[model samples]
Target: MLRGLIASGRLLANRATTQPARLSRNLVTAAGPTSRCSLPHTHHHHPVAAVPALARGMKVRSSVKTMCDGCAVVKRKGRVYVICSKNAKHKQRQG
Candidate 1:
């Protein structure tokens, strides 16, 4: 019983009185991928010279027609697609 009490006392005496401040890890760097994007890469692990503005996607929607000048509504495989050849960001799909 005396040994147990001494060991508990020793453990309490060795502990730090104050906790250390936590580090702030929310720093954003310009060199990070979020700041700048590299060239479009293919699934084959090959980097392409450029990502075509009109990337084929099945999610093109009809409302995206006025988003770009090169937008065109295309029908493929019984589905509707809004394809923008000039700007790939405007691509949308209609259900």
Candidate 2:
């Protein structure tokens, strides 16, 4: 009796798993083979030459290599921007 119960339980579990697959198949047929909502019909065509002009021939500045000197904030004409280790850590914590 215990073995029979275990077999029935497994059969029920298998049927439940198969139910979702059958439901998906029926939904696909009803929607039509070409009109699947999960898959996008129209794909956006992106430009092959999507590279920025600056990236083509950009010279790296030595100052920009170690930008802000590991400090959280820097004042260049009194305009503040997040550019350091502490600032990044602080931003992540805030988020």
Candidate 3:
């Protein structure tokens, strides 16, 4: 039941991002209507931080709120593990 809920939530999130995806597509099309251009040319600074930050916050909040399998494993280690783009995993594993 919990897994179903989680899966449903993921699906909803994926659906929600469709707008941004479409917007990006439109931006690409508009940038070069006649020719194929690279995506980096379309980059524009937004008022707020980029989408990656928002996604990170959502992931952190969800992980903190729910005691899911990965969180449980982290809890057993007596330390909190946060996912960051720079450092994927916080600590190095010892054999």
User: What lDDT does each candidate get?
Assistant: 0.62, 0.56, 0.53
Candidate 1 lDDT, 42-62, residue by residue in tens: 667556588567645555444
Question: RMSD in angstroms, candidate 2?
Answer: 12.8
| TM, every model | 0.36, 0.35, 0.27
Q: Please report the candidate that would top TM-score against the real structure.
A: 1
Candidate 2 vs candidate 3: the lDDT winner is 2
**All models, RMSD in angstroms:** 17.3, 12.8, 20.1
Best by lDDT: 1
Q: After superposition, how far is residue 95 of candidate 3 from its true place, in Å?
A: 81
| Each candidate structure's count of clashing pairs | 6, 0, 0
Clashes of 3: 0
Return the clash pairs for model 3, or none: none
Of 2 and 3, the candidate ranking higher by TM-score: 2
- Off-target runs (Cα >4 Å) in candidate 3 are 30-95
Candidate 1 residue pairs in backbone clash: 59-92, 59-93, 60-92, 60-93, 61-92, 61-93
What global local distance difference test value does model 2 have? 0.56
